[model samples]
Target: MGTAATDDAGSATRALIFALVALACGHMLSTLLRTIPAISLDLMAADFHIEPQALASLTSVYHFAFAAAQIPVGAAMDRFGVRPVSLALLAGTVFGAVASGFATGPESFAVGQLMLGVATSGMLMCPMTLAAKQLSAARFGLWSGAILSIGNIGMLLSSSPLAFVVDTWGWRAGFWISAAGGVVVALAVFALVPNQPAEHKDHSSPMAQMIEVLRLGLSRPLRGLIALALVSLASSLVLRGLWGGPWLMEIKGLTRVEAGNQLGAFTLAMIVGPLLIGMIDRRIGRRRQRGCREHSTDRRRHIERAGGGSLRRTDCALDDGGHGSVVAPRAGLVLSGRAFRRPSPAIAGDRCRRSDPQLHELLRFAGRRC
Candidate 1:
């Protein structure tokens, strides 16, 4: 019985890893879709004779599609399992890639990019959901981080490596390669990932559930986080996904390869940032609350006392029950250079383990400007 149990555990672990890897591939493609335009925009623009305004619209279409898909994807995931939903959507990525490879005009390219965005929407969320169902809560963060790190590898590849490909083989070839890889990733996901049953048996209409979720979001406590997330993420996407490369090449006067290398630093930070944060969060554990609070308060006080300038609207997130623990609000300052508004006293009283060590590192990295 002991031997049998060990064998079974090993099998499950392998299966879990396999599923994560397949999902990671999807995520990798997602990142590639986002980053490719950064590196290949010049080539694409030249090929299609795209004007500046059209180029901007073409790229933004992906984000538009991606954001629009979230609610419908969530509903589909609830009705179907992760496996089928993910696989089906992933095919969109493949289609988009191939279509873009052969695109003759800006309009066609935009359609392909939109399809890519829609198809790859489930990449990260579905895997995390799968982990929640299959693994322990303690392991969920680690696995999610792993999956994100793997996706960052795609971002990394889309930088200097993709630049090399575009330089040598032309940008169209790059799209074809991505399309082929997407097919392989889809097949792997289909074969290896097991179907997960719906977590909620409520059988409520998806529209109703979506409406309820939106209603819950109307709560005051969630507003600041939502606002912070939207503003910061939107700006980052505009920079990284759209204009970063042009700025580096034009303003900074860097070569294409050099620009790609610089962007690689951003991607590298993304890859390492979460892992380091997770480690810090884990180590700080319960100490996060009292220690982080004291440290932040005293540090801010000292800085101002020492003439460091008045601290901006620095906010700390106290824990809340029911929902998964959000990183302490101070982390937002560290990560995004913006402090969130503190939650209400009622919301703050609900406690969870502290996760501020990672925030400290982010603060330290970002410097006092945040």
Candidate 2:
């Protein structure tokens, strides 16, 4: 039994390592889809004689293709299995990269970017799906987060390193190098990835499934979140993918390398944002707990001394928005008051009963002060 358990653990470890390696390649390539234009925008504009608006639209076609491909790619993963779908997509991306490098005009370059976007759409999803299958549910989130963080290194590379490459060998040479790297990744994926099928097949077609998700799965709150994500992600992609380098160079009066360095700093901040937010969230939770306990204890002692009787403890809880009401008693009446916090307006008003007119007035005055 022990030997069998040990063997199983070893196998799982190996599978996890392989899955990460395969995903890393695809993720790095996907980052290139976002970063290539940032580093090479000037070269592209000059090469194709395109204006700023035209250039933005051309590069944005990548995001358009990526968004459009999601449903079909998810369906492909469900029905055809991950390995084949991923291989096909990654190969298309490689082909697109090489074609873009060799593109003679704007039309060809646009087509290449569209293909690249379509191919790279499944890069992150395929790996996540594979990880879900390979690891336990409890471990999935941890492993997936680690994989994504590692993949961000590609974004880092696309900054100063990419600038150096483009400066030394030219932008076209950079794409050619990426194509070569894609080939190497493709081989690694081919050898490492298995044809893992969905655990339960959804008989619905891709479009049908997508419609169902929109109708049933997306609640009002979820829809709001999706809209928020759309705005934020759109801004990030537009800035990092197209405008950042140019803005830095033209407006900020920085060299290409300096702009790249600034972009890298921006990417680093993005990477750290979630961690900082998480830490702050935990701290806020702890403070809220401590505040609640101390407030309850102090209020209860005051109420007991004033009323000359014991007070019953009532449960008070914050809503999702982190606002709540505290209930306590003073003399012969009950007092309900609210408190405010950051990110939302505070509550300060209080309500009391006329059972004790004088006490009610005093509590009302205290509430106003509170």
Candidate 3:
């Protein structure tokens, strides 16, 4: 009997691991979708008949919508189970990818970004809330690291691979492929994640959960953390997603392919950071708060603080640094210097020539005169 019980426990552990992996893939998809614009901003702007800066600024809507959705998405997870909420978000994500892929103008593209924002807002939390509920601190620490490592693969994908796809097939192809990836991820979640009941016993209305999240954001404990997240993450997102590729290509005189290679290499350290920390946390393991009652506020705070200590990257949406990440992209234009924003009329005319031969010739002649 003892052997049989041990086997069952092992089976359950394997199943949970599989489920978290599937959910983490959703986070990967989120990373891929959001960062694609970074490598191909110029291409997207040319296609949309706008300046690169405009498109970079416009894309901030995705982050805003992402931040705003955190409240309702959290509430939905509380009222409904993580699996259902995740599945719904995945479906929405696929739909948004398709919409973004087919967009004919900036208006349509922004609509798609808004959809993606709402859809992907909850992805990091699904695997996280589940692990936080089920695993001991040591176990959760290890798994959280694994989940982040998986998600960082998305940024890696967006870098060189996406740049190649954009250069060869155009920016639309990138979104089309991502849409297909989203479908695959959804199927994996549907198959691997079991139909579990809502683990949170919050009888409070969904509205209450939403309100509570806002309240906590303002509360003293989290305020400084939130601001620090803002400054650090905002700069990183803007640098990586908004200006890094362009800066390299425009200022450093590197080819798009070369720029992609450098950017891709730069992300390697981030992918590994979490695993190292998780290893240390596992070495300094904590006792069980895995099945502790959340009937009391103190226990809830204890788990939030303790879990956040090592696993903050599970990214609590707000903690994901949404506000700052989006807001900082515009500032990137200023910091990157003048070459990118105005891009000498010659360069603009050269890019515009793809769609208009006459204008390209005119710009070339005009460039000689200047």
User: Using alpha carbons, what is the TM-score of model 2?
Assistant: 0.71
Q: Rank the candidates by lDDT, best first.
A: 3, 1, 2
Candidate 2 local Cα displacement, residue 258, angstroms: 1.5
Q: Candidate 1's residue-wise lDDT over 174-206, tens digit each?
A: 789888888999899988998767765367888
Index of the highest-lDDT prediction:
3
Tell me the lDDT of candidate 1.
0.69
TM-score of 1: 0.76
Please, what are the lDDT tens digits per residue for candidate 3 over residues 52-149? 98998889999999989987987788678888999999999999999999999999999999999999999888887777667764577678788888
**Candidate No. with top TM-score:** 1
Range of the 10 consecutive residues with the lowest summed lDDT in candidate 1: 361-370
TM-scores, all candidates, are: 0.76, 0.71, 0.75
Looking at model 3, residue 232 earns an lDDT score of 38
Q: How many residue pairs clash in model 2?
A: 1
Residue 309 deviation, candidate 1, in Å?
20
